[model samples]
Target: MATTASSAVTASLTSVTLEVADPDAAHRFYSAFGVDTRIHLRASETPSSGFRGFALALTVSGPATVDAFVDAAVAAGATVLKPAAKSMWGYGGVVQAPDGTIWKVATSAKKDNGPATREIDETVLLLGVADVKATKEFYVGQGLTVARSFGGKYTEFAAGPSSPVKLALYKHRGLAKDLGVAADGSGSHRIALGGTGSAFTDPDGFVWEA
Candidate 1:
């Protein structure tokens, strides 16, 4: 029996929501992060009673970390909802972006020994190739910008105005050997760069952006 499209789509699932503290500031910050800041606001003003404080909530690592994040957000034009401090749950306090989004950054009390899921906050795509130099040059020629490099084995590329999209290049043979799939110059993967660009494999078994 042929597989249904819904089943296939369900097999490949990912979810992410962008929350901001101040609507205007959040829009600006996200725009700099390479996201198009054109989403229509559902609502903005604080409700008379329900869900007071902060527009959006973010789960942070801890109080200090949340504080640092708040500082960065403020520097990036976000407004503070509450200062980072100790939470009643022994974690950290919450932060509000200018858009009224709340970020809850806290430390996990116990380690999770379960399925590993991708972080929605950031998504990185890996591309395998034999020659890193040539791959980098190809992207540079195609109007993309190179940001950083992990030695000659790998290089990072810019996907946004402030954020970066990683185009990791591992040894083609190493990747092929590791993935148990031979490099046939036809296999493919899709990387949604949050509006920056998508990466795909080329006929020469190299990855390119579109």
Candidate 2:
């Protein structure tokens, strides 16, 4: 659905809405990060119903930063889904956020290379949508320029070079394969965002918080 307003829109996401049983508690737990978040309380949802389809990726420049960041996250109620260490991709680890969302914190230092600086870098929101083409079109229709895209597999968008975070989309099964999870994601999408786009849900159920 295109409109004159859609064409004129200049959008950037401000939050990821999550459906939770307790908004206050989830808010308290997620408040540790600077990223603004929204919570929706729904009693009908199963324990696994919310936020099972995506991962938040945080990147730093080296190992020590990754460890410290992850350590702090764990201390702030996040649980280690995967221990921090050097992986083929880089130095990083996985943690389950308080709202059941998964987070992957890593350094740019790849296992094949040597050391990089210890400075923390960027935090990116990665969404796993059921239909990449449709999802990409939805955001594009809302006036967010895609930074990069790989056929129908992935897409990234951010505000120029200064924004510390970026939004991305990927094919649902492809993302799940990397996380070693089932691809058939369901239940209350439990997430939302505010930006240029009209309110809508991608094929897999991730909702736009606006």
TM-score of 1: 0.33
Clashes of each: 24, 6
Q: How well is each residue in 113-167 modelled by candidate 1, as lDDT tens digits? A: 4432222233334456657668766655544556566655666555443432233
User: Could you tell me every candidate's TM-score relative to the true structure?
Assistant: 0.33, 0.74
Tens-digit per-residue lDDT, 32-92, candidate 2? 5433432233332544653377887877767776776677778778888788887677788
Q: What C-alpha lDDT values do all the predictions have?
A: 0.40, 0.66
Look at candidate 2 and tell me the lDDT of residue 13.
Answer: 71
Q: Could you tell me which 10 consecutive residues in candidate 2 have the lowest summed lDDT?
A: 1-10
